[model samples]
Target chain A: MHEWALVDAVASAAETAAEQEKLKKVDAVVVVLGELQNVDRAAARRLFAELRKTKKKALHRARLEIRAEKAVFRCRACGKTFGLRDLNKLSHKESEAVHFLPEMAHVYTECPACASRDFEIARGRGIYVREIRGER
Target chain B: MTDPRVFSIGMRLSKVRRIIAVTGWKGGIGKSSIACALALALAKAGLKTGLLDADFTGASCHVILGARRSFPKEIEGLEPPLVAGVKFMSASFFSGGRAVALRGEEITQSLLEIFCVTQWRELDYLIIDLPPGISDASLDIIRLVPRAEMLVVTTPSVLAEETLRRSLKLFRAMRIPVAGTVMNMADRNGRAVGDKPLDRVPFDSGYEKTLGNPRALAASKLFKAVARLAAKLDAGMVRN
Candidate 1:
């Protein structure tokens, strides 16, 4: 749901040729995606597949690249930050596990400082276009 | 770069299904009606069909399908009802028409969740009846479903055509194939006057043609024709 803005960003950049003249021949567009956002990799590639069909000169040979960014979790009670892989050990999915703060079970995984369940999501951010390559 | 990692690690491997998003820039152009008719047609053709009413304002697919309430329980990844070979799902069944108050993003989220969490099993075609115009909700489906195709509906009126053209451009930009265009409210034999062809609409070429009052009967006939066209194309696409 939240990935549309990111999709729009990719489309907007490509439609306007934001950095076609930067440097070197371009053959692909690379995007960095966050685990927090549910970005469909196949859809992103398919969108570029359609985009390249028309702009054969530059994007014709270009492929859309997607790389995942790990999700970050934070504990509000003691300001703790941890990766989702670690949270999974505590029986929590990346997104759902973060919400289980000190409130639900204060003894489960307390804040290192005060051993509290209060927590908030931090670090693992949204999606963004990291690089664009084309014939310079 | 043909990244094998995307295919192996990142991409969600779901069944290959055709997603047909039926839309009309203007309301009351029989978008939902045509979608339902087409879904039923495909279902009868022995294709596993799923109809989704993306129109959050007026969820009428439920009424057309003769079903009520979005199925809360899934019978093994199949939440839609099995009626006459077609499976149906709609915001109407879930919200009871209360989805209108939801924000645009909320509607998109619900739409995605319906696709993600619902037990569609192995559907051959998923027909989505989108809300009016080229809004965020429409874009959400377009962006999410890489295989999503589009069908534009409009009345022959000039205003409707202009609006439908803008929508056509949107689909083109998204690279979604336009299956076909339908002109609703086409000239009918004077079915409105005296329940006979005698009350032919002025300038109507076919004076012998007589349609019925309330306009639905004539519109329904048009929908059936469009359904036949869709069925033909769908079958061909599958074969090829």
Candidate 2:
């Protein structure tokens, strides 16, 4: 599953942070999923749980926390600010494409006000590792 | 907050032995053609190879290789489909041949997503067809794939040669290893741009018709020239 790859990244990042901080055991990790990417939280949590067991000892017992951020786009040509819900509905194929590579949003979507493709993903564009807490 | 994708890129590429980025500073200089042909040549020589069309907005390797428009399978991650015995991945599969307009930051994000999610398992040579110029894709490739060696391509025109020299200087300043240069579409009597040794590929008038036909492309004069260059690269691998 694609989520497995993403979850693996989260685990890998947490492990690296734990090692750098000289943590003996990682207690929790917080991950944020941007709305534009639309990652499945349940799948990410499950995969992270499964992946932690195979990682280093510091990450073996790490708990995974998931969060979502609303997607916002600002047009460069017309100075229009909008959300994904304000744009035209995407086809199943287009949505799937954006799910894999969120940058595909620019290919399929345009600014609702001016119909311009030039826009900035002002917020909520990708998956990120928010925080990692551990015991030294 | 940190992007976790950056941390896993090295792990994803751990099994790949060599990464050769085919690049040129100018467009229409045959970077894609050379990259695709080089991949085919390496595969023909019985080496495990993968070709990644990193020119997200202007992806043409899929067209050159005649690869079908099929989504890569998701097994642990997206696995590049095998096309003509070479593992192939491109943004064309996602865009469905539509034009993708992206800013520099968006390009970097998409590139990171690709490097983080795609799995190229145990490849002997992974050829990256880069976009033209020292833009986001080229700069990010240098930042992301530290082990990648540049295979510069240029035409016989003085304009192309001037840009090639500038690119070479930039690469040297960055301390990037240039595997070699290829003088593509050169005249029979044309000399190498500089004192450095370079492989020359004479212009093949019939090369255009061979596009989208892997068999014909493999049998073309262009392919034969690239195959000779591939042999040199393979030999250099042994020396290294």
Candidate 3:
């Protein structure tokens, strides 16, 4: 369900990029999905393949590559940034909460060293289309 | 020149140049009302403006603008319907007065759907009415549109200030440009916390009764302040 939207948004963005670059065909689209959001690479690829077969044949020759990014957060108090791998130090309850409910991430997350509740999500919060490689 | 980095991975970029989100830390503080007024004010000022009700659960922009459910034409994709001088879209148009029961993936998908499919004309500003609280929907909006500026709404109560602080911190910590604060439902003692008051919208029964009328918005004090703020934003005179 979520992959369709991601694929649609990515495909549309590629269209605008394609038009601007005067490209006749798109070669490959690389999508880097954030761990924080709910999206699967297989689902995204399946959707992309289906979309290419539709009326938007401009993407017929294009290949889809989906990559995952590790979720990261930056502490506001100490200004230290850490990734999900650091969560091994967290209590099981806190880690589970973050893994299940992404919106409640702030509630579970705190600076490991300083125990600061204040932190800005430095990365892994947004889905990015890293590159749209096409042939002119 | 359009930067490739600015676009979301697969998002079809619309012509809407500037996107502004009106939000509050808590609910029932008139976030939707001010968002509507600001968009209407900009439209009234001869600028092409569009308003999207991102409050998927509580879609009331249609009611505020006195607009009925309209099926917007899909030129190449979905579009926000033009209503009451502001090109607007709300969940009510899709749900048909029924409650929308959407979970995590559904919510994110719906938002992404709107972003990818919506066809927008060239516009000066696009105002979004965000749901109260730091929900997943709101965070995605911030992440989805990285260039978007934020406008916070709050009442003058101490409780409101306490909650507003968290929101202010989130924006500040994330390095998002906060346009300014509008003290909605403020009295004489009502003050915007942390941030300077860009405008004060007092609780008025007169304004309440005329909410759905576009003609009445033209003379509203709220509209004047938002319009002035819009002018400042357009001129790049951001508040410190």
- DockQ for every prediction shown: 0.03, 0.91, 0.05
Score residue B128 of candidate 1 by CA lDDT.
86
Please identify model 1 stretches exceeding 4 Å from their true place: A1-136, B1-13, B69-72, B75-78, B96-99, B188-220, B235-240
Error of 3 at B135 (Å): 1.0
Candidate 1 lDDT, tens digit per residue, B108-185?
545544454344557888788988887866887766765677777676566777786676676667677766665655
Global local distance difference test of model 3: 0.70
Regions of model 2 farther than 4 Å from truth? B237-240
Name the lDDT value of residue A36 in candidate 1: 53
CA deviation > 4 Å runs, candidate 3: A1-136, B1-11, B195-198
Better of 2 and 3 by TM-score: 2
Indicate the worst ten consecutive residues by lDDT in candidate 1 chain A.
Answer: A97-106
Ten contiguous residues minimizing lDDT sum, candidate 3 chain B: B1-10
The per-residue C-alpha lDDT of model 3 at residue B212 equals 73
Q: Model 2 clash pairs? A: none
Model 2 per-residue lDDT tens digits across residues A1-136 = 8878888999999989999999999999998889999999888888988999988999998899888899999999999999999999999999999989999999999999999999999988878988998899
lDDT of each: 0.55, 0.91, 0.70
Candidate 3, B79-117: lDDT as tens digits = 677776788866565554545544444467567656654
